[model samples]
Target: MTTADLHTLTGAYALHALPEDERREFERHLGDCEACTQEVRELSATAARLGLAVAETPPRELRERVLREITTVRQEPPAHGRRGRTVTTGRTGRWSGYALAACIAAAAAFGGVAVWQNQVAQDARQEANQATRQNEQLAQVLSAPDAKTTSGELTGGARGTVVVSQDRNQAVFLASGMERPPSGKVYQLWFNDEGTMRSAGLMNPAASDDAVLLDGPVDRATGMGITVEPAGGSAEPTSDPVALMDFPTA
Candidate 1:
């Protein structure tokens, strides 16, 4: 594989989803590349945390279907007697037993694959539902009768806007020409209440321009601010804000 292709395998490698040959190749690459190694480590940790999510029980109908299918599978009688001597009927009987075992192994493998696919489908559905809900909330704020919008300038000539609705108690932040943040740091939003600042959330570092719905209610917040903070963010601002948008007086 090309170097770029190998780099993209960090996630799959972290999840142990790579084929044996590809996994070995990636592991050898990992020994020399620091960035891929770090990424794989982080992805593995994130995967571990996500694994803690509660798994849903299979549907009753699915269980019943499996049970019914089980009844149709032929059972193999013991090949050995109580005296521990082989009790083979003939050469055909031994071959039949081998074929049955192979069928059973294949069925078991397919069953595992089915379960994994179902889990992946469930995770996708949950993520889609979450994104839908967020979009609905953003629409409410943007379409509110009392919503007001304001714009401001960020450092390095970038610009952003804040659209807030007192009735909805929500706000949406939109930015343009945003540069990538310095390594190990993130662009964080804050709810500027009077003189105090509360963390709204972190912006997508990779997005040059994006709309973000602020994380909390706009209650009594006179303005919004964006600051560069360490990754994962801080409880309080550690540096001057790159941009600040003051809400109009009510």
Candidate 2:
């Protein structure tokens, strides 16, 4: 490839889309070309971040569509031909093939980046929406006219609290210094109805110190309790309560 062509391949090189032979040539050129090397580095870092931006899996239809196109897309022809075929001289024919391929690869790299950019933006918006919903739920319980707060000490000197709003039929659980459960286990919240226990929800492992809105209505439960249970939580508590707090009397 020509010097100009090699320069144009920086994006393609960063994306690893160049064929084997051209990729080796580009690597050797990178050692002497400072500009190309810097461009490659920036593009590579952007690519890595985009890869991690989305957690949802791609749809199967997208994969199948791409596979179908691969079969029908016509590949570029070779730059030179057999002795019997006409061969144009100079850049018009010999170098045109390589240049065309390099340009296409560069375009593909930019297109891929664009698609990732859109996906990342969508993921960010979705997370923001979820956070907003959670905040609203917490606010409802905290601001209710009948809201009552109860505190208790958890195992290992941790602290736990519940903000119950009977009028709204909602409650929020808060914890501080709550350590992660051991492997194969999780922390679960429960509604204590007299002597019977009903599962409230599994405590979030990601944020041990954050407030969590209880999963179900406070209903007739007189108090809340926490227990260590197997991962995914149990239908019923199988262990002793680590923490319990009874709601204040009316």
lDDT of 1 by residue, 1-250 (tens): 6554465555444444445576556655665566665665555545433322333446889855754453233223221221333222211222234655675578687786566446645543443344446655766676678978888787888887787888889888877668867766778899999989999976654445656678899898999888998656788999998888898555
Instruction: Give TM-scores for every candidate, taking all chains together and pairing residue i with residue i.
Output: 0.57, 0.52
Name the regions of candidate 1 deviating beyond 4 angstroms.
Answer: 1-107
Q: Encode model 2's per-residue lDDT on 1-250: one tens digit a residue.
A: 7665566555444443445476567666665665665565555545433322323445989745754443233223222232344322221122345655675578687777566446645543443344445555666677677878878788888787777888888887777667756655667889888978988876643233646677788889998888988656788998988888887556
Model 1 pairs in collision: none
Q: Which structure among the candidates has the greatest lDDT? A: 1
Estimate the lDDT of model 2.
0.62
Name the 10 consecutive residues with the lowest summed lDDT in model 2.
86-95
Q: Which regions of candidate 2 fall more than 4 Å away from where they truly are?
A: 1-116, 206-208
